[model samples]
Target: MTELTPREIVRELDRYIIGQDDAKRAVAVALRNRYRRAQLPEDIREEVTPKNILMIGPTGVGKTEIARRLAKLVDAPFIKVEATKFTEVGYVGRDVESIVRDLVEAAIRLVKEQHGRQVRGRARAQAEDRLVELLSGATKKRKSANPIDILLGNRPKEPELSPEDRDKLVVQQDDVRTRLRAGQMEHEIVEIEVEEVRPMSEIPGMDVNMNDMLSGIIPKKTKLRKVEVREARKILEAEEEDNLIDMDQVYTEAIDRAEQHGIVFLDEIDKVAGRGGGSGPDVSREGVQRDILPIVEGSTVNTKYGPVKTDHMLFIAAGAFHVAKVTDLIPELQGRFPVRVDLKPLSVEDYKRILTQPENALIRQYELLLGVDGVSLDFTDAALSAIAECAWQDNETGENIGARRLHTLLEQILMDIAFNAGGGDAPEVTVTVDKEYVEKMLGADLHRKDVRKYIL
Candidate 1:
């Protein structure tokens, strides 16, 4: 983060996303500001807060994509939640505070994964030793005593092994270890003891802390099971990894990461922006917005792991605003999001770039998919232009879904080729998609007056 400037962040985003320059620039600056805040003195840093962003645009127009790509670029903990999924505090639906909890959970998983990688070598070595012991039958056997002797509080002891037998056992164990390291005993079956944890009872939409407490009180049970060496190695490796990790440190770092680098993308926020009228769903809409205000502004949320502070966490909210404008939101809630960016509707040229320009372009994806069946797909420039024009015409005539229309258009254009690629009646080994082929595949849909009735 300290190494990447705002310009570099935007440059990185441009590879996958086609347009929405304003949105990209706004997010880049916000991310860079986080780095800047970290360098400030403690007092000044504590005073600074994130200038949350609000993106106003139609659906499928790169609003969500910009936020998602930005989070991935920085490797931050991210969660996308629809505003409609939450309701007022007294309502039966999920509360807005759950958003912070979800973000913290993501942070814990991210931090734990990093720790796991750091300890993988040690964990593997320990697991290999355990596996060798299991294969060599070094585990102590329990003796079965008579019932009368057990009742009298007396038990027989096992005799010590002779030196010669002990030396032979050591040699056999060393041979097994050598074979195990060379991957020669992976298929050998062995019996191992595994601990089983009881499942805790859960109530719908209940706080997670109570479940944790209930689970902690239950004693773990162990059982022996026979498994192949390869499968057992995986199980033991995971167990060793868990044993090596310190939960206290994981929780502390996870909380710090959530406070500093977490990003919560609130989508469909316009759905919660209401007219603030009398009783009904509209009333709850405004209530939901009010509920989200403090979290975005800065507040502490209690999660199962620990209490997480949202002081410096970045919040990027997006909404189409087709039915309600941004002004409809409560004043206090709207004030939290100071930066605003309106993404432009995608154009035909944008569609063309989406199909051919990006690193994971739709055309390249299809080519790779078809190539798996020994079919070669080639698309001409004229064919790309025709396809983009058709997608543009469809969006203009019906629902404007932006670049997503290409998925439908391309799938329809190559349906027969994909279904029969490995069949007896497949097309030529090398298939070329030309302008005429595009017209033949999609011309009828483009020319139809009732575009909604024409399925792709």
Candidate 2:
């Protein structure tokens, strides 16, 4: 972060997004401020508050992409939430504070990924030892034979073993260990005890008991299975890893990292801004915004994991404020977002750049998609211009959805080719959708004002 200037950040963002320079620059400056704050005195650092950003733009205009890319660039904990998904407290729906919890989870994952890399070498050695033990059954404790052994009918007799016999037994044990490590006896079956654990879903939306409240009452049973030596090694290695990791420590560091660097991107926030005060849903929308105000303004949220502070954490909120203005949000909530950047709608040149310039351009995306079916898709330079012109015209005629218009325009243009895709094998397909082709497809309809009014 210290190494990157705001201009460099914008440069990185430009690779993926076509335009929206204002929004990109605003976020870049906000991010750089975070790095700047870190260099301040400790006492002053605590006094510094993050300047949250509110991005207003239509969908597919790089609002979400900018926030997402910003987090990726900084390697920070990031999450995106829709404003409509949340409701006021006491409501049956999700509470806005859940976004903070989700951000904490993301932070934990990031820290865990870093920690895993740090512990890889040590973990590998431990895994190898566990695998070797599984292969040779060394984990089983050896019991000393009783000296009264020769007791036949309660009569005790002194039994002596020859030195050579003892030496031979030691040699045999060593040879077995050597063969086990050398993969010479990998196919040999050995009895191993494995715990019987019930399978459960980890998906959040699914009906699964995450707390495992009944686990204490349900006794764990052991099952013995005869598995090949090599296969058993892998199973044992995983068990060993589980034993080595310290959950308490991981959770502690995760919470700290989350509090420090987690980022939450709240999308469609204007929906919850509310139009002054109204009844039913509209009233609750304002209530939801009020509830979220404190969290965005820097407050501690309690999660099942632990209490996490949101102070100093970056919050990037975005919305398509076509209906409600940003000012409609409660003053407290609006104040929380000190920085605001509005994204501009795309132009024909912007659409053209999107179709050709980006690494994942529309042309490249279609080519890759069709290439799976042993089909090669090639779009001529003129075809791109035609596509952009038609898209721009449609936006002028109807509701402007930014870059999303391209998807509709491209799909309409290639409908016939895509529909008859696998019918027959052709030698090659070269399509040049010039101005003439563009007129041919959309000519009559585009000229008709009523068609533009309705179809568009």
Which parts of model 2 have CA positions greater than 4 angstroms off?
121-245, 276-282, 372-374, 409-456
The RMSD of every model to the true structure, in order and in angstroms, is 4.6, 8.1
lDDT of 2 by residue, 109-154 (tens): 7776676666666776675555455554445532433435423334
Predictions in order: lDDT? 0.87, 0.76
Per-prediction TM-score to the true structure, in the order listed: 0.88, 0.74
Backbone N/Cα/C clashes per model: 0, 0
Task: Please give, for residues 85-158, the per-residue lDDT of candidate 1 as tens digits.
Answer: 99889889899999998898898898999999999999999999898878887655547666567657687775
- TM-score computed on alpha carbons, candidate 2: 0.74
Q: Poorest 10 consecutive residues of model 2 by lDDT? A: 149-158
Which portions of model 1 miss their true places by more than 4 Å?
Answer: 140-166, 195-200, 209-211, 275-281, 423-428, 451-456
Best by lDDT: 1
